[model samples]
Target chain A: MRLWLPPVLLAVLLCGLSAGMPALEPLFHWVQPDKQQVIYERESFLFLLQNHLLLVLISAAVGTLVAVAGGIFATRPSGRDFLPLVSQVASIGQTFPPVAVLALAVPVLGFGEAPILVALMLYGLLPILRNTLAGLEGISPAVKEAARGMGMSPLQVLVRAELPLAGRVILAGIRTSVTINIATAAIGSTIGARTLGDPVIAGLVNGNTAYVLQGAILIGLLALATDSLFEALERTWDRRFSPQVAV
Target chain B: MSVSRSESSQLMPNRVIPALGLLALALVWLLDVGTIQPNRIVPGTGHGLVSAVGWGGAALVTSTLAGSILLAFLNLRGRYLIQLALLGLSLALLPLLLDVFASRHLPEDSPFARSSIGAGFWCLLFFLFLMLIETLGRLGSRRGLELLLVVVIGGSWLIFLQSEGLESLSLVREFNARPAKFEQAFWTHLALAFGAVAISAVLAFGLALKMMRSPGWQRPILGLVSFLQTIPSLAVFGLLIAPLSALVAAFPVLETLGIRGIGWTPALLALVAYSLLPMVRNTFVALTEVPENLADAGRGMGMNERQLFFKLKLPLALPVIIEGVRITTIQAIGLTAVAALIGAGGFGSFIFQGLGQAAMDLVLLGALPTIALALLADAVFTMLAASLKPTPATA
Candidate 1:
């Protein structure tokens, strides 16, 4: 229960801040004294927040499924021949800057949510795939052999033994993937995706510090909320799975 | 031995390379290989492989793919070596194919007319590179061979891109328009990315030392740095604006020193902040993970603590520390591009400006170099780390 507290509090703060941004106009006026309209009015902070979350959520779901499946395939005996290339691709793909990937998508797919979605999915999968490989490969051959000796089939052993053992690291990979997707989704606003970055980009263009601050605070809070949620999850996983290990 | 030989032979016909070959063959004919534009803003006419570069070029591409696929079925000794040579040659000369496309399809009369790479060309280049990686891995090639390949191919592309035939390529045209700005962006990007890495390396070293001396300090410092990293780059840049502008307002002297609210200052701060997690974590682990016996041996030699650190521990830790630097440098290069949003003036300025104007080639002009810089940094630092590692027997 205590482990869950931080994430809950952070989520509440994120929601409160997003909904209450307009009420703080007097404060924003002080931040930007010369501007006639200090508050960002083109889009509501809540709607932008929702859109940003939807983009990240959809990409994260699809990226996880694809990356995990790819990792499993590469590790299996049937797909063993491709493991080297797959791992190489996973690591090398990360060297690409996410912003460059996002930019490149615009030329090929044009400006819209679709391009950003594809970019997020592709970029987000790399880290997850790398971690999935690392996690699954880190398991010892002896463990699998023992499971086989116990008369369990390969599919049964994989589902019952291998995946459970690798789940913690896979969760860590998901955490990393989500964190990056959040940041990239914010930048997606520049490519015509409606996101929290809308206010920040608009503020930068118009030289309105208030709008910038509002967007920045919300983005910062969203990231914090998401990170803390992952922290609580990792702690729960650790406690439930590895009670013998010290924190 | 006989059973193992049989099993290995059964696995002989490599499936990955042939599959990639088939995909490339399809894409090269199915998709546009290049596009010819009359001007910067308008959409261009798409050209297939034969239309863009003639049947000769088309035959050359088809033959390369067909040959790579055919070689996989040969079951001959040293097959991977032959495949490597063939693919490496093809990859090294890929830019000339584009040059051919530009020379053939580009309108000679219109100064504004330019040609850009299309999906098929990108697919061909990508599939060829994948095949090369597979072949290299199968051959268990030496690091020297890989480096030689990179240098040869990179040099070839540089020469071809700068050649007269490709002058009408849209990416080249964009660079030609603002050569001075391109140079400045290059320098600014190098300075900002490396500057942040250097600063954080020193600060993280100090922090790591402190954590080593007092274990209680470790959690709080790591926590703060990771927290800084979790915030999006734009938000960090945005968050820094208010306080920085207010500070400059309060201290007018900072304006003359070029410390603004939204330029390189905030960018440097944010980059340095983000760099700390990897830098400190690696430094701390590297220093602490040094074997205890080595230090005792140094003490047995009557060396003081400082001498033991400088002579024994630091040298052992250097490779891991350099590994951390590699990660930080690649990350900083990417973030520096994002920092352009806050007026830091790097390659990202070109990306954003191009996006604003809907100029795809200009965006490539920014993005391609950033990716190249990252790949270069990755290669250099990887080599440096490998070279710094003490051999197992010696250690």
Candidate 2:
């Protein structure tokens, strides 16, 4: 029930801002010129929200696939030697900022979603990869031995025992990757990929506080919603995994 | 038996990867025509690699092919020397290839007809990178070989910097055009990154200590910092603009002190805000991770709360705290580039300008230096964290 509070509050704030509530006008009053006021209505909030969600979803899905593949490969007997290399590559991926990636990628991939997608995927890779690796490596050797003793093949053990145990941690990584990508995706607008960042960029350029606030508030709400949803999912996972363990 | 199998497999040279790489490079050079193109002045009308570099290019290609063949035959013991030599030769070929292409294809006075690095060039670079990685893996901890390679590469880069062959490259031209501006931007970038780190360290440490003392404040303070972390940097910059402007308008004195809606003031504030989470979280974990028995022992010895904190908690937590500092500093350095969007002067100015101009080299000119700075900061902080770490007690 407490989880609903954030979204409810966010909805109310959005409504008030969209309605241009007199109470909220003072918040943006400083942005006005002498004896003049301006209201921002440049882009549709719903459209921006959808665009932002789409970018995050696409990037997170791709990043998850790549990171999980790399993570799984590194944990394998033959591939264990590549763990340090994989980890270093992922860290370097993160160290280069998403904006720098966008800047560099724009030339090769050209502008729009391609470059932004590349940036977000690279930016989102580290958390998912690191967490996935950690989660897999954290599994006890006893569990593996037990599964093997029960006549399970390596693949069967991995699927039935190992992955299930690592599921929550991997899910947490995906959650972190997706949530961070939500904010980082805003940079996509700089390279002509329209998202919630349009207003933020527009406001920065034109000095329209209303536009900035509107975009920021919507993005903040979206991030909060995503975070809370992940929290709820985590709680559910926890409940399922250990009924005896108290919340 | 498994160990022997693995050891034997490891000892056998992995020639396939490097050979495959060389094959790709050879195929690109031979079959993939139009590898060198005139800089995209009028879209795409450039000659093939052979015509671009003429006879000298063929000789260079043959040499590289021979080197790769030699690399495949050589055992692990003697491979490092050959790999190092091949790597140096490959590095030298880049500028030579460019220079030859420019001289052959483009007329001397036709500035617009400059040679551009093409798909073939990129393919060669990819091959070189693979070879370097493979060699590094095989060489293991031959520190002397690594040092010699670095010195050779560094010396070659220095020579490349002075050579006119690189003059036609757009990145060099951009640098040559605005050397002073680039210098200023570099310093400004350094200042913003380091200055923000210094301020955030103090604030984060104070908040962390406060949160440690008061359990009630922990949830709210940590939540707030985490929430702030979620705010995209641009949005944070935007959010700060109005309030900061209003503050300057109201105070008037702040404006005199160089506080304004846009620039370093907001950039620094946003950076400090972003930095607080990692710093506070690390500090909190570090402080808590210190054994309760130690603190209790300190208290039992008649040490006051202040003494317990200063003498026991802090010293124990210092390494982790320094780790946090390292993380925050590296993060801040990377982020300061974004701060340029808000009129704050930094390397980002060049990045954005390059973006506007659609100049890849200009973007690189801004970006390369920023990446170098982040790496430098990372190395320095890593050393600091290592030196500060408490050594394990002898048995």
Q: Write the per-residue lDDT of candidate 1 for residues A1-247, one digit (tens) a residue.
A: 9999999999998999889888999999999999989888898889999999999999999999999999999999999888999999998899998999999999999999999999999999999999999989988898889889999999988997788888899999999999989998998888899999999999999899999999999999999999999999999998888863232
**lDDT of every model, 2 decimals:** 0.92, 0.74
Listed per model, the TM-scores of chain A against the true chain A are: 0.97, 0.85
Candidate 2: RMSD over Cα atoms? 4.3
Q: Specify the highest-DockQ model's number.
A: 1
Q: What fraction of the real A-B contacts shows up in model 1?
A: 0.77
Residue ranges of candidate 1 with Cα displaced over 4 Å:
A244-247, B1-11, B392-395
Q: What are the per-residue Cα lDDT tens digits for candidate 1 across B1-395? A: 36465446434988889989999999999999999999999999999999988999999999989999999888787677788889999998998888998888777789999989999999999999999998887766479889889988888888988999888889999999999999999999999999999999999999999999999999999999999889998899999999999999999999999999999999999999999999999999999999999899999999999999999899999999999999999999999999999999999999999999999999999999999999899989999999998877853
TM-score of 2: 0.86
Structure candidate 2, residue pairs in collision: none
In model 2, which regions exceed 4 Å deviation?
A: A4-30, A33-37, A242-247, B1-10, B15-75, B78-96, B112-127, B130-151, B291-316, B393-395
Report the lDDT tens digits of candidate 2 across residue range B260-328. 988899898999899999988998899889999989999999999999889888988998998898888
lDDT of 2 by residue, A2-121 (tens): 755665776666545545534555655655654244445565566677788888998899989998888998898877756755665566556665567667777557778878888888
- Score chain A of model 2 by TM-score against the reference chain A: 0.85
